[model samples]
Target: MRADRLVSLVLLLRRHGRLTAPALARELEVSTRTVLRDIEALSAAGVPVYAERGRHGGFALLPGFRTELTGLNHDEALALLVAGSRRGAQAFGLGSALASAMLKVVDALPESHRDTAAGAVQRLLIDPETDLLSRRQVAEEVPDAIVAEVRRAVFAGHRLRIRYAAVGQSPKWRTVDPVGLVTVRDQGYLLAMRSGADRTYRLSRILAAEELSEPAQRPERVDLDRAWQERSTRFRTGGDQVTVLVRLDPARREELVGTALAVRAEETDADGRLRLEADFQDSRHAVWALWQLATSAEALAPQWLRTALRDRAAAIAASYTSQPES
Candidate 1:
């Protein structure tokens, strides 16, 4: 809002319109001569700001005059610098570049403002939970351009061309339509649709990713929530189903179904027996549920479950018999 800069800004807008000298001087709180001098200064700086001598005159940004980094309040600028530093550090191969960008912005600030920015950065702590470099070999310095480009591509619905590597798989180049970006434990994942199915690829796995010119058209009727639900349901189905028939003292039957491993309750018979069914992702997951009521447990329908339990119990007994208490 200082007079000199305000005059320069007013003249910068005049290229698109006309600002009377009086109005320009009033806005800048300066004399008409000073406004003229400011305009000359702008022209000297190679700015396209110009003045027109006419009654219908105001100020405007000339055609194709796009402002960059304009009108950022001090607090907003500081917040941006801080947030970008944190997120960029967490992003694959972009940490150092963000820090460098922040330094450049700080250097451009006024002495006092620069001190404030530097102090803030010193006081700020950016502790990412996951060491992103652990998964891949990246040169220590990360570039800011990668973070900016990836963010632009993710939000614009663009397909990405990536050279990606997976665990136990060779690195390969593939084209994928990115659906969403997932941040987990400080690591970033690009969730995408590949071969018409949802897949997750780690950002670190990507040797390179470039956005395509054309926007990717996602499935017209894709239900994201339903897709997540179906995925979880399928994973549950992949595990073994165990049916537990417990002859609890009728009082304990209710408590038995409340066991941790009980996925759901089938029914309780008249004779105080509870028929419980549960699904386990693995024997460990199932064992966790059954172990909650293992003392009062019975294998009711699936005779194989009973045999497995007996075998485990026999193994325990045999182990004890084979080795006396040392």
Candidate 2:
């Protein structure tokens, strides 16, 4: 570990030319005292690294000192830097580790490729919160303390107790043998077994968590992909979902499908709109999703859903027009 830090320290000074002990500490994620010790170690090893004394002073290597770490080509380095810019690592509490690793990647690159790769990445934007239509994406909030407890249990192979708030239910404490953690579209889930039955809990709904020292009873090896697939299939097939046929504006077809469980059929109509048969969790789910399109979406079949929507619309209209009580 010390060897790796020593190497990273050299790389940092090599790339930045001069950095104060405090600055080096920040980059290396260590204390100023540790940075000073590293400098002494480097100098003792015959590497001419010295410190300047004045306010503008810092530690610097002897002029012409450089390390040739050209393992990744220009394109490869660029790819890595770009991938490192993504935000998913935060979900695992590895955000600081990721930042440190990226710094090393940047510093280790050959000088000629380093500057270009770093500069080119500035032009790319990814996964902006507010999309094109100005609707902001809402990210689920999972407190760091809860996430940390759950993560420790999963990685340590221990039993986990969580205060989970299932939809429409009060938060309750339950113990489970955690299998793994999965994140999709910024939402996190804990795939675990409760009383030997498969259960999945949303991380956002985990109000609190405690990692038990007792070892988890899960199999020594797990294929999380397969586990997640089986759980998802069961959930989808078991739900009391309703299938609704709708005539939707062609422009709003994507928006409608985005919230649907499945698109059963599709065809274009004479009016240049889309006739879509889609499945939603239930009548309420169907109505809520379709209502988002306003006049652009019309329920073609399922008279009950259409009636529900009509009554809902009338109520909303009445609310707006009815006079306020004096």
Candidate 3:
């Protein structure tokens, strides 16, 4: 662990040029004393590290000094290249940083492995703009400045004031305690809280943002995965959840389940059709999701849904069957 810290300290200086002891301590999640000790160790190891005295002074490395510590194998290098291909990083305003890091990784590879790894990465495509069906995956637009401020607030545990435009509502300003930022299906969301109540805001919906001087009121250490799960559970259960019983083709069972919020019960009919009880956000959500399956799925219960589907089908049939007067 100490060795890793030493290497990290060197890389931090190499990347940022110079940093004060307090800043280094904050970045390394250690105390100023530990940072000073690490500086002494690095100097003792002939790392050419020097410190400036008085205000406006900090530790810095000798100019043009860089450690060639890139020990990535061919596969590791290719893995990083693949990860860098994702568009999700752009939502968080790290696109250029990711690109630069990938370039550095490629340059640091051994001469013999470089060409092979580069050639292999060329054959693999990730997060393509369009799939074989010619359907485009449009990424949500997030202002670079807004994303940067939100990101800083989340990472630095600072309160954030945002001008948010909720769906069908006028934009308004609100201050939130940022828990974390998440990207799902190319859309970014800031999972935060206002007055201890969960407030999940989409990055695209943020018109503006400012990182506040006051510290955020949140846990020092957050388990993002677990927190996301808990929030997901609350969202799925607390909304106007409607249960839909559906009879679907056995083959399309997964398609129906995947689009639903949750499956309450599932069973197979004797004739081989799949019967599922699924929870949806609301009536409209249920109708829209079921419509995608077309004739492959049927809404079994909730007579109103059946009527709505019947009426919709009748309207469609009427449109096609209408007589044309010439």
Candidate 4:
């Protein structure tokens, strides 16, 4: 771990030019004393590190010094190349940085391994634009400025004011303490808190944003994975959840179950159809999901859902039923 920290210190200086002891400690998540010791170690190892004095002083490496650390093996290089082919980085506004990092990784490879790795990458593709059915994967667009401001607030631990357009509601401005950002399936979300209440806002739905001067009231060390999991559990359990009983063709059973929040029970009927009791987010969510199966599925319970599907089918049939032109 000390060796990793030493290498990281060198890389940090190489990237940022100069940094104070406290700044380096903060970035490296260590103590100022540790940073000072690391500096001495690097200099003793002939790394040419130097320090400046006074209140505005900091440590810096000699000009034009860069460590040629090419430690990636062949499989590792290909793994990185395949990961770089994904569009997930674009969702977090790090597309260009990812591209630049990939180039550096490729350039760092040994001359003999570079061509073979580059050629292997061509045989694999990640996150293609269209699937087998030819439906395009549409990625939401969050303005670069908004993403930057939100990111700044998240990293700086500051509060943010955002003009958000919530689904089915008018756009309104709100102040939130941003906990973290998450991008899933090309959609970006700002997981935050408002007046001590957990709030999740879609990045694309943010019309505008401004990082506030006030410090955010949040935990000093945030466990983002835990926070996200807790929020997801609350959302899944708190909403107007509905249990839907549906009869679907055996072949379409997987499709229905795949989209539902959970399957409560499942059994095969005498007619060889699959009968499933599934949990959905709400009535609207259930209707939308079931409708996608078209004639291959039928809602069996909550009489209301049946009526809704019947009414919708009738409306569609009426539209198609034509009278002779006069």
Candidate 5:
């Protein structure tokens, strides 16, 4: 473990260019004294590490000192960098580790690949916090300590205790045997089992987490991909899924399809509009999604949905009716 820490320490400093003892200790999850000791050891081993004095001072390597990298082709290194650049690692509280690994990859790449890949990554953006219209995408914030504890339990195959807040329900404490973790579109889920039944808990909803010493009651070998897929299938099928038929301007077809689970059928209307049968998670979802398209879309089937939309539109119209011009 110390050996790994030593290498990680080097990688962190190399990545950040300079870091204070306290900063290094925090990233390495050690003490400032340990960081000092490590720096001394690295220096004694002729690692060209030096310190600056006064405010804003920290330890740094002499310019151009790079440890050799091995076995990584250009594409592999680029893949790691691109993944690290995204919010996926942040969701799992692995941001620091990812940063260190990214630095190693960037520093170790061949001179030709390093510059080119770095440029490519800089130009390619993935999953920005907001899109072109400046509408922010909501990202669930899980406390670093809680995420780390949950991650430790998942990796060690230990039982986990969590205070969870399920949607539309009160918070409750429960113990689960962690099977694996999955992150999709910046959301994190803990795949686990409770009483031999599969359960998935959103990491953000976990008010707290405790890793227990007891072994997790999980399969000896878990095919995480298959497990997640099976669980997802069950969830999508078991819900109050609502299918809606809608007539929408062809220009906004994607707008409706984007929020739907599936597009069962599609055709052109006599008036040159697009008609689609789309499936949504629930009636509430169906109403909300189609409502966004406003006058451009209409719910053709499900009289209740049309009524709901009519009522909503009527309410809005009533609220603004006869308003004084400012």
Candidate 6:
């Protein structure tokens, strides 16, 4: 662990340039004294470690100091390559450079570890047919580069001048106080305030964006996390609100709670049946929850929800009707 910490300290400093003792300690999950010792050890190994003490002071490697990548094992090398292949790597716009970097790391690994690394890479797979409309695409496929810039501005709390193409309207230039970026399933939206109205702009429809020299004031009562969670929950349920009452056995109740659908326990019956009341964003989640329940629970109230659930059940039955016995 200590050796790993030393290597991590070197890498973190190399990536972030510098970090204070307290900050390094917090990040490394170690005491300040331990970080200081690690710094000393790096210097003893001929690494040029520079230390500065003050409100703005921290530790950094001297400009010319670079570490040899001779320590990464097979597992570490494989993990790096796999990370470079994930959706986040492309989303972050790292491009093929990450793949090249991973190759370099793999080459640096010992001969014995290289075969294991190759086998691991071959076994690992990414499901491309799975939701191709990714956040990375949202960032990369805006009508113009300005939309991407506006997303960055919103994240950085900067003001923006944009030519926005509002829903069912022609594009118009506007100066907006960028609020936040919203990603719901396949769609990426920018939340901003214009004049007196709050608006959400579809990233794909944005015509252009320009970051302003001056920063905009952010809302005093903004809850970005809550907003995102609510939006995601709504999107998952297909946007029709319904309250469902279900009676479940204890085992089934536990299983239901483990699902993506948010459920609340209302009461427990005398016969040990659990009564659950849940606010569903739409009929889809309600139907999904019902299917999971099968014959274990009764879905009461909201006639449309019941109808939707029955229709889904019928579809499942229809799928099986034409199947021949093997």
Clash counts for the predictions, in order:
3, 0, 0, 0, 0, 0
Candidate 6 TM-score, true structure as reference: 0.51
Residue pairs clashing, model 4: none
State the lDDT of candidate 6 residue by residue for 1-326, as single tens digits: 89789989998999889899889999999999999999999889888889888888899989977776665554344345546345433332233445666777779777988999999989877635345545243334544355448756776677888887776788898888877765543456777777746666776677778888777666856787776676566555665566788777777776666653566557879998888887665667677877877888777767776787778789988988886879
How do the predictions measure up, each by TM-score? 0.41, 0.68, 0.74, 0.71, 0.70, 0.51
Candidate 5 residues 1-326, lDDT tens each?
77679889889888999999999999999999999999999999899999999999999999999876675544344345546446777777766666666787788776978999999988987778899999998878999899989988987889999999999999999999998878887899999999999999999999999999999999999998999889887876777998889999999987887889889999997889988998889999999998899999999999999999999999988888897779
Q: Give the Cα-based TM-score of candidate 3 against the true structure.
A: 0.74
Give the Å error, residue 240, model 3.
Answer: 2.0
* Model 3: per-residue Cα lDDT at residue 184: 76
Candidate 4 C-alpha lDDT tens digits along 181-295: 8877788889998898888999999999999999998778878788888887788787699998999998888888888988989999998988999999999999999999999
Kindly indicate the candidate among 2 and 6 with the higher TM-score: 2
Tens-digit lDDT string for candidate 1 (65-171): 55455555543444455454465344543455455555656766778677777778778665543465564433323244554455556667887788887888999
lDDT of 4 at 110: 72
The lDDT for every candidate, in the order shown, is: 0.60, 0.85, 0.87, 0.86, 0.87, 0.71
Question: Of 2 and 5, which scores higher on TM-score?
Answer: 5
Q: Tell me the spans in candidate 6 whose CA falls farther than 4 Å from its real position.
A: 1-46, 50-85, 90-101, 104-116, 123-147, 150-158, 161-175, 179-214, 219-240, 248-261, 266-273, 282-297, 307-326
Which residue pairs collide, candidate 3?
Answer: none
Candidates 1 and 5 compared by lDDT, better number = 5
Give the C-alpha lDDT of model 2. Answer: 0.85
Candidate 5: RMSD over Cα atoms? 14.8
